[model samples]
Target: MPFTVLTILAALLVAAFLGYTMLRGRRSDEPTAAYDLRVYREQLAGVDRDLARGVIGQADAERVRTEISRRILAADTQMRGEKAQSGPSSVTSAVAVIAVALVLIGGAWLMYHRIGAAGFPDMPLSERLELAEELRVNRPSQAAAEEQTTPVQPPKLEESYAQLLQKLRDTVAQRPDDLQGHILLAQHETNAGNFKAGYEAQRRVIELSGSEASAEAYSNLAEMMILAAGGYVSPEAEEALRQALERSPDLGPARYYWGQMLAQTGRPDIAYRVWLDTLRSAPAGAPWADAIRSQMDDLAFRAGVFNPPQLPVASPGPTQEDMEAASELTAEERQDMIRGMVNQLSDRLATEGGSPEEWARLIAALGVLGDKERAIGIRDEALSVFAGNDNALQMIAAAAQQAGIAQ
Candidate 1:
């Protein structure tokens, strides 16, 4: 704090000095040229004295006197010119001082407020990293963070719909171990902006699922928790995301939330990289896709990427109706359908050598089919293909994570 104060004081002093010099410009009776005039006149007198004392001959004295007179004339002209152009007028000087002060002091303050962490003392890199870790560890829990937030207004529902929701909630309360009931309750409540209730139901869903819980379940829990806390990624929410990643590391929503958590915890550089990969691969219109897109420019700036690559236009893929139709198929039929597409993709990628996005999709598809060995091999080859490309590497790594393959 003392050093900051001293630095500010020094800046003010330098500004004062600059303003004074500019305002005082050439406004003096003894301008540099005026002083030169005096020196020339004295030299002319010295020449006369030298002649009287026989220090030089008459011709030499005359020549010296003439040279001094010419210098005096030139100095007199310069002095008059300096006097005429002497600095700005009083009003102009005042305006100039104000402008300088504003640019130097006011501008500095504005820039600092935009980017600086006010009141934070400078620390060594290691100390800063330690402090960041401590903050991550000690940040508020989901419940506490939710308590500090104002609840969002729930959307209006028809009388019949509202009553049906209430009945479902009551049913879940009575049958606390009913996983599907809790899941339905969670989905509806979250849709209605009743995030607190949504997260509560989601917690029960996770508890019942236990080891059987899919990554989507844990990721959904984290999502509701974040929404309940007014978008703050609390420690509890982060734990839910960690659990999701443990189950399926390439889980899109979980990676999205993990990136957000990293940014919140002062690791924006890593978050920037994480989001760059995740955003490109997230299915079009997913909640996290839009959220990540909205935040990428700011995150890129924070990560020192002044000119980040053009954001990928999330390509049109499967529609919700299409996905629902696929979900209706029997297990064997659906598996056969997926296997066919996966085989086609695998062949195309092998022969044609497709995009990073395609390779990532293929890897994730293999993971879904429980083909970890093929997924790992495909991941390795993909890494080799895009060895020097950082963004491609991140993409492959995100998919590789799902199959438990370390980069």
Candidate 2:
């Protein structure tokens, strides 16, 4: 980019210099030449001094003096005729230089501005000019922007998921009992939504990390296990949730999801109470805040506590037992389960009775069933039901990949 910019600048400079030289050449050929008066007067004085000092013969000095006088008289006549033209021409040249500079600078700025093509496709022409002018006028503001824009240092390569996983696996393979390695593995697995792997890892973390670290690991494992349960509302999910809550009652996500599980299992009143506790105790803007709010509204509507929002209702997610069972299934069995899920989802879509959450559940079920094309079609229709969300996009992509379906 820098080389291209320099090449462009060199071209413009050459053009300007050529234009200035052509103009000067045209002026130089004029019959009425512009001469400096001081140099003419100095030459006349030098002739007079030479004549007085007898450095030159009087006749020779006199002849030279006559020629000089004639040239001075002719110059005075020309200056009188061209004074108005000279002043205006000088001003015009100066204005031309200024104008050319502005044009060159403006063109350069526009070209450079286009370098940010990846991010700002919708920039308007007026906005581009305004930004360029602002940047030129404020050096300090420009400096601040430059500092802000410097590329962020890349995170340590060793900490990356792939590298860390390899290291953890190697350590576990050698020791087969390293708890820290297990804890790292569990965290990675949970993040990747492999809850069974996470559960195994968390067990190792508990063994190696002692009671305090074990408590945290257990909480982490419990949350993921609940997600994998697949809405069956199992006893294991409930027990894990209870243990996690006992360890850290203020964990907002656990509280919110636990309340959701309760609502699913014919305990709306209990769920409503739990959500109320969550709202009061959980920090505002915490990760689970939205879930808590939505769940609260759902439970309240179910218990006839208040009118609900116009948003569509959704079915609860899988239970821990369901996830554990699914994880143990052979690949063929898993495919069968996915196909069954897709059929069920198709029926639900035909009925169109499920709320937005139910529709999302249906979408995910289709992806899991290896019906990427159909899943995307359903997703398009169901998108209006749920507001746009980053997590929703990621989940769809993940499910599609797992089912060996191209997104």
Candidate 3:
């Protein structure tokens, strides 16, 4: 009722203001023509004074006097013409003011009826956060239950590979307490695109690891679940990600996925902050870094944060000709070339104590080459070098963890 009263009062104030502006008589302190003529007369007197004082030549003073007199005559004529024309009729002015007030009020009403949430109650921040929390608790369970009842078609695979997978599954079941076996099975299933099975296997790995489970284990489980749900970050997945963050606050995958959850939940401002912070702290070439970088600017703008300048499109990597030339090389030659490049990068970093991003790339490369020992060594060296820089250390550690290096 108070709001309605206030709104009506505001409308009345606007109408009154507009009506007065339209009906008010134009009362100039002095008429425009009269003001101009007075200025011109003053100029003529100044020219006469200048001539008397011998400050100007007589010819120059006469020229200035003539110009001033001509302006005075023009002003006098204009003032007479203005006086002859009558002002707007009082009735006409009243009609115009009324028409304008009605239009403004009626137009505002029409626009509000068309586009405004006329009947909706205000949703304050506290209420919104409560609703979000409720959804977080209830939605995932419902989704998981529905998933269990729904039949899923498994991807086709070679008979031998399928047999091998079944054997691994059987081995994990027999040795339910074997954490390493569950972890291996989970990884293998994920690699084969069997995310549903991988999700189950990863859950078992988390259970077996118990209190020893690191953020990476929980994050991996969350990722598998997301994959199983066709990339939907269900509440269950969100819960797992939350746990991951609780264990390791800067876990890259968890932070990235948490941002995704925030965005999906219609909290763009929070999501923008999360993704931006993650991007700032993330190592270059980290698994999640590129995705976060590509999306952050758009999210920031949507969240009413500053609009970022458009970044130039990056050049495409490794042209067709270059790929073809590389393809022509023997497997051994390619391996040797890659190893050489990796070695050079390692040497440079060791000598120069390069960026955390560079150190992350070196660790990832070693992992890819099946040199977990070397990757671990590099991770340790990077941690020591960046000991005082917590953000850098976190980025490198997360990258190494993602790359399967023992931390």
Candidate 4:
């Protein structure tokens, strides 16, 4: 039902209760005088019975009857007066009651009209509040218009890739001096596994950036070379990595690739060491660290090597003896301490830069650590660096066999 109607009904119920209470009291205030007459009649009967039984004199009985009749007439007259007064008042009272009821209903209707915009019949309070909020945020903007616009179809991935490649080619032709453009092109080619194109692009970037930016370009080129070299590491690839490491001993890419070459040439211990050292230098999220870790796990699984799967970026914390010995360590103790220190250095190379010598050192460490997977990846990276260099490939393969890694 409508709120107004409910409110009116409630008011009427209250009025009825009050009216009943008032009217009920009126009955008590103006009680019937007939009971007084009955009492008077009973008293006269007693007087008559007394005279008949000779229990009282006739004079005494008559006197008591007269007094009772007089009191009964007086009470009857008062009751008539009260009735005459209340009868007219009841008419006004009833009009007042009806007026009060009409006023209550009208007030309820006014209140309902004021609140009727809330759509109480259908919408709930929560929905009404939400609608109010929407009305308040009525800002006009181009973004809003765009949001309302329909979506357009996008090109397929292959078509998009082709378009991007064409744009890259055009951009490179038009803006030959843009080193970033070349880098982007190289990245795209690398992602598409177009190692030749990627290598050429990286070479251009290296030329443009010169030695200053050559390290990054070299890293990319080396990665692509590894992909291009397949399983055969070559001497030329080895020389390129060596030069990169020579320029920057902390060169992570060169170290990682060289480690792979070592593993491929049957030098498992050397390859494992390279990865272990690389891990020490590599940051937590460095791709080299993750790749090396994966390679290590694979190698361990294949070769029955039990190096920890996912070693920390540094060698596990120092041993008690190493800490206590301070300066005078035994040969074995000294080796352990050096191993730990070297592991830390290699991990730093993975993160920062490394020299060719450091790369070599990392390889030896991996061999000691027994990480075949990293060793193999290093070999693969090396072969790509020195493409067409058979000696490099042979060395890598020999190391792999020696490391007990299957072809």
TM accuracy, model 4: 0.35
Better of 1 and 4 by lDDT: 1
Q: Candidate 1's residue-wise lDDT over 1-407, tens digit each?
A: 55456556766877898888886663554667977888888888888888999999999888888888899999999988887777768888878877887677776666676787667777887996887799899999887997899978998999999999999989988998898999999999998889988989899888898889899999999989999999899998999999999999888889999999999998888999998888767776687788888999999987888999887665445566767978999999889878887887788778877899999998998998999889998998999999999999999999888757656
- The CA lDDT of each predicted structure is 0.86, 0.63, 0.79, 0.66
Better structure of 2 and 4 per lDDT? 4
Q: TM-score winner among the candidates?
A: 1
Give per-residue lDDT, candidate 1, residue 63.
Answer: 84
Higher-lDDT candidate among 3 and 4? 3
List per-candidate RMSD values in Å. 11.7, 26.5, 12.7, 28.2
TM-score of 2: 0.35
Q: Mind sharing the TM-score for model 1? A: 0.60
* lDDT winner: 1
Per the 3 Å backbone cut-off, how many clashing residue pairs does candidate 4 have?
A: 54
Query: Which 10 successive residues of model 4 have the least lDDT summed?
Result: 136-145
TM-score to native of every candidate shown? 0.60, 0.35, 0.51, 0.35
Off by over 4 Å in 1: 1-119, 319-407
Candidate 4 residues lying further than 4 Å off, grouped into runs, are 1-156, 174-177, 297-310, 313-407
Query: What's the lDDT for candidate 2?
Result: 0.63
Encode model 3's per-residue lDDT on 1-407: one tens digit a residue: 54434455667679889878766654333556888888898888888888899999989987888888888899999998876653576788788777877876776666766876676666788997887777656565525743754445666889999899889889988998898898899998998888877888899888878899889999998888877776668888888999999999998899999998887776778888888777666653466868877787778876888965443332223334556877899998877767877887888787766778889888988888888888898899888888899899888887798779754
Instruction: Give Cα distance to truth, residue 41, candidate 3, Å.
Output: 15
